[model samples]
Target chain A: MSGGTTTRVDARGGSLFAGSASVRALVYVALAALLFGFGAIAPTHLASEFVLRIGAGGLLLGMLALSVAFLMSQAGLVVLGAASVYGGVGYLFAIAMSKWDLSPTAALLFAFCTVIAYAAVLGALIVRTNPLAFMMLTLAAGEMISHSVMLEGLRDYTSGADGLVVTFKGAVFGMTAADFANATQFWPIAWSAAWILGFAAFAVRRSRFGAILRAIQENEERMRFSGFGTYLPRLAAFVFVNAIADVCGLLHVLNSGFVSPESLGLSVSTNALVAALVGGVANSTGPIAGGVLFAFAQDQFGAHGFTQLLTGLAVVVFIVLLPRGVIGGLIEGARRRSVLSSKRRRTA
Target chain B: MRAHGVIALLIANSLALASLLIMLSSGLALIYGLRDVINFGHGALYMLGAYLGYSIALIGGFWTALVVSPLLLALLGIAFEYLVLRPLRGRSHIEVALVTLGLGIILGQALIFVYGGEARGVDAPPALAGSVRMFGLSYPLYRIFLIAMGLGSCTALALWLRFSTSGLYVRAVSQDPSVARMMGVNADRLSLLVTSLSAAFAGVAGVLAGPYLSVDPGMDVTMIVNCLIIVVIGGTGSIAGAIIAALLFGFVQVAGSVFLPDLAALAPYVLLFVVLLIAPRGIGRGRAPA
Candidate 1:
């Protein structure tokens, strides 16, 4: 079974997007340009403060969605409770600045250390579980964190339900705290973060490690029989994706200038999952694109009080009717058309 | 007598929580048993039932709501099984799980749209409104009724599963659908029956829980997660296991609330983690034989 499984995965991989490296490069370059283009144009042409703010949120969500997409696509794990990691980092940042009175750089460093450590410990325990167990465990973990944040004992640190208004003492890489507060100023940083993380995921996807990860996803049992210690790669992917989500959490807190328990709620986690699925979890680009669209949709419907309706409909329709998500559906359609045209050429 | 009273009060509270947990988790366990579908939307169904109960109780009365809500929810459950769950017959468990998750969100949001965001509550029926003397202490009559109802329904369900023909079909389907079908059983019908029955169970629980707990849109997610935890700890697809774990956790939660208020919300989750560590297959595996 292991041998046959490995060959099947290899065959599928080569036949799909990997057949043409040049095409892949062109796709990567185009994605990078589009990401940068959005950041560049949003501050000037778009210019609406509300639009910029929503875009910033979308970009942050995009980062979170990319992390989710990475795990779902590469590891076959549907993490239902990512809010623990996301909100955990947000609280960490808020506490660092407000309670501990740490500078931005020191606080950023602290957040990094804590996030990696948290992911390492949680991922080590979680990566060993089956898919269902993984979902339940993550959900439990997220709930536990959310509960703890609201506890009276942690009120001084977490600010309870009122949330903590972060007072940035100094500049972070030439951008003042006020600059970070402004959505337009923060848009560039958010885009840069998404681009770097998105490309990193794309690069990893194209690398040999990506194939190995996919194989692990396809059949962990087979991969194990093949003498590959599958645990470390799985754990690595979990931690990496978690780290990306943690960054997203941090950016969200920094941009909003406040952090609250809502950041870690089940809704937040579910929203990220919906965004990733709709964006097409098959690739990094799809989730990022999906996050932007989702945020825009959220802003639009939220004002009119149809946010939940739209979100629910989007998730159900996308998964049931179009499982590939918007981008994935488009990609599949193009592939099918290409295949048909090639068949015609052969007949000619 | 005073110390005994405190203990009795705690026990009563625990029983109330346990009954609610049993009602919600059993449905989840049953659905998982029959189809291996996690039905993340179980919570939404529960919420919808509560809302329906509120409306019906207002228009017709508590007794009428109690009867009508489950029937209506069962119909809705059938529609759900046919419309959403039926199409993805041979898909991966995760895909089905995703669809349910989406459906749950849709249902929850639709509930909010219809019922509004404010928390709503139903009143205990006039006859059962006050306190009753139980175990040498005064306990809410409505709560005691809930406990009795939960225990009675659970017992009835257990017996039906063990002895009835339809129950046998459900058991056979869970054990192996193909084998069950080979034996001339209609697997599709059985699947629909189990799904609807499971959903009806959730609806019943929701109606019972409305007066005890808040009837609100946001309650769905939290309730679903709790039911998920209970199902996991008990081992999925095991009715007996869900019942036992629900009772155990109900006590654990009440005890935690009394002794460790700050950690009470986390007590169940922490217990789940420990159970996963010690017995990854879950404690009910051997006992339930699933």
Candidate 2:
């Protein structure tokens, strides 16, 4: 009776890895190829500088989205403040580089450490709360960061609302000569970082720690009953994902050579959420797909009439019609078709 | 710093703060507690109410606008529920919240496009324009009237929620939609009604706030962030919780501004952090059912 009940619950709960292996593999490869192609050609695109900008922008947004995706898709934590980590790291880098006159390498290191500390502290505090409260707390934390940046006394260090601008150090990996010669030298670094992070995420998703996180996502109480330290894992996931966002923040400051309040604003946070949702929260490559599509749509419709109207309409439509997200919806449809076809053959 | 003057200032400020917080936070709490939606667009609705009131008052007097704007906003809320929110039900609450955030951005920018982004304030009606002598100090009579209106509305809302069958149905559905449905309550219809009513309350607050606060496109961001903090500090599903939290926030804000003006802006967040530390479930005993 116990075994049967477990199977019944498992069936009703739905497995994350329900789709066929071949389709999943194809989806992953297609995503990898698209990222490579986009990164390669973006800097050269002349119809507008938008493609290249968004390619780089998507990387920054993707990093943040990935952080939230980890919490939402893996650990079942809905973090509304992932953008705070992104913005906080960027703020740290800007303050270090511009205000303190630190070297780029030193600034990057300081920023990463600060974000990790912030995430760990906040994660430990809010991890035990319900999802609703957790979401609100993260939002409050994000607002605090934004407001603190706006405070007048911090103007000397933070530049107040005027923001901070820092000069780039040209190159860090012995690619100075090549970077100066070619305009797209930074593309390789950004693209390589994307691939490495993506691979790391995939591996993590397949690991024992990842399995524990997934189990927690599926049923936190059950995992707790099984003697797992739920709070520690959730906190670890929060810090790890936020650390990834911090890396993106470092890259953003490096690429743009400037940091502004907009980098950490609510819009940046919302865009990351939108991108993750558009990509498919459940799938490993969903954020990549969502990031690309959001960037593309942002570029395409932004130049025309009303950008907010277009984007808002798209979000509303997607939420209503494509709740599983673009990639997830496609995967689901294909799976259903395959199942129906196989059943027909058996009946015949 | 004269004794009577200080007392008057304190009374006026406290009253003003109480009125504003109660008006804003009540709508937020009702929407979240009843509908299970954070309603990120609550501020947009508030802003829309102000603008609509401005236009209507310009043509049809202040009292008329005060009455009509909320009714119109209620219709808009009904339309919003039927159009945007109803379909998105049963999905991730985060997505629903994001969609509303998107709607807010769109509505904000749209308002800017339609009515230039300049800040506007309504002129108080001739009858309530002058000051009333209070505790040997002059205080704006219009503000006192606003306080009365706000408190009256809050009392009416509380009584309705406690006494009426529809209100009981809203409470029941909010507690457990499936159980409420089994108990013969139409959960979807209750959600729609509560959502519209909550938005209508937001509209009333906006109209009351228009004379004292400037209305502009940028106001939505500030307003929404403040309301969200208010709701978070208050428990999500309790009107009494909202009242207590709002009063505390109002006092902290007013007192902080008077004493520590520079840190005054940070007071709400400090309060929020403290509340999170003390009661992660919010201040009141209202617990949203899982």
Candidate 3:
């Protein structure tokens, strides 16, 4: 009797995903190529140095948003504490470079290792909860990071609210700190990171682990009965996403050459999550698209007045009118058109 | 300061904060019980109440602002329920939470735009402007009033929930909406009513807070986080639990600031982490069925 019930649930996609492998591979390659092409030509073709700089900045945020999209679409988790990982990594990078006078490459490597350890611990704490609890825990985690960064005793190292300024020593991939800071020089690096990360996201989505996660999302109980240990996959996904956020934070600090408590604040997390939602969290491309749009919007609207006001309204409008986000809406329209055409062909 | 006097002062301060938190979290619990919607915009409502009270106090008096601000917020709550929240019915809990999060952002920023970025404060009523003797030390009359009001409303709410007909209806809907619907109870209307009442409580908190705390754009986020911590610690949908959690947090915050000034902001978060670790469901006995 239990076996019958389990099979019925299994058919609902808990243990298997039915997407065509070849089609997914093609789409992933095309996405990587598009991002690579955009990065290579953006500096030369994009109007002014300002917009190119914004594009580079957008790519960093896009990475964070992509991580958001990854966790949401792959594992059915919405993380509100991504800023903790992002900002925490950035602070580590800054402290290593400025306080310890470490080389840029060494700092990046150290920060990456530390972040992996950090996320592993945090992931273990939060992976067992429901969505609501997960959200609050992540939020609490972000606040904890922010508060720790701003503590008075830590002022010597973190620089507290004044922010820590770093001058990178040695070269990053044969380029000086100044050269790397150049928008034209930085675009390729940022682009490469995005492309690689995007491909990684795609690969994970098509992996067996990804299939199990999707299954867990569909029905946790069914997966458990199937003898799949659910918590490990969920925790692994959380750690992986945090690792991605950490990379983004590392790049962000390198580009800006400073780190502050604001990097860990709720606004940073909110922007990334909003970008994921706006771009559509269902696929890899949505977050990248959303991040660029948000960066541009912030660039334009931030100057006038009440930037937050506009951004806030934008998020609400998106949620109410277009819950699936921009990419989701387009995909839906295409699907509907295809359905209608198929119906007409059948009728004929 | 003498150690005894300092302890007494901290107690009074924590008591004052406990009152504000009780009002905020109880309302949040009530709405969560009925609507299953965690109003992230609860903070925005509180901020709006403070701002409106400030304006009303300029023309009328502190008492008038206290009375009128929450009434005005109840109207906003109704419109919010009708427009923004109603569309989110039958969606996943995360989606509702996201929409409310968005709503909070909109409302908080809109206030910032309208009022500008400066912090505004309201004067205490003339009658209670001075300090009064309490314990071994003198305490602000306004602080004592806050403590009294906090205790008063908490008792009133507890009694009503236990005794009143509408409160019974609220309890019924909170326990199980589908069953309540089968029993001919109007879930939608009760949700709307509960949302408005929740908003009203936040407004009352805002107005009461205006005499001491500065009204600013940033206050919304701070208020939301505090109330969320209280609600989570108390367990969702449990009013009495909210009160206990509020007092616990109030003392932690004030006492933390005094003793471990650098880590004061982290005290509540640590508490939240420990509580969740101990009871994944929540700290309260009133556990909602997952």
Which candidate achieves the best DockQ against the true structure?
Answer: 3
lDDT of 3 by residue, A1-348 (tens): 874454444433332344566765787779867867865776656656788789888888888999988998887778887888888887888888778888888988999899999888878877877667677678777878888988888988898898888667678768787876788778878878887888788889999999999999888889999999999999999988998898898888778877788888898888898888888888777898788888999888889875666667766787777888998789888867755655454456
Give the clashing residue pairs of candidate 3, or none. none
The TM-score values for the models, in the order shown, are 0.92, 0.88, 0.92
Report per-candidate DockQ: 0.49, 0.41, 0.53
Each candidate structure's count of clashing pairs: 0, 0, 0
Q: Rank the candidates by TM-score, best first.
A: 3, 1, 2
Compute the lDDT for candidate 3: 0.83
lDDT of 1 by residue, B128-166 (tens): 899977666777899989999888888888898999998
User: Model 1 off-target regions past 4 Å?
Assistant: A1-47, B1-4, B286-290
- Give the per-residue lDDT of model 1 (tens digit) for A295-347: 99898788898776777778778877788899998999986775565555445
Where model 3 places Cα greater than 4 Å from the true spot, the runs are: A1-35, A42-47, A342-348, B1-5, B286-290
lDDT of 1: 0.82
Quote the lDDT for A90 in model 2: 75
Off by over 4 Å in 2: A1-50, A168-183, A334-348, B3-11, B174-182
**How well does candidate 1 score on lDDT at residue A75?**
86
Candidate 2 C-alpha lDDT tens digits along B1-290: 59778756866777776786687778777767656778878888888888988888899988988999999989988998898778877776666776787787777778877888699989888888999997677889888998798678789878888899988887776667678889999877877787788778778877877887778877777777777777777777667888888777777778778877766778888888788778876787665635
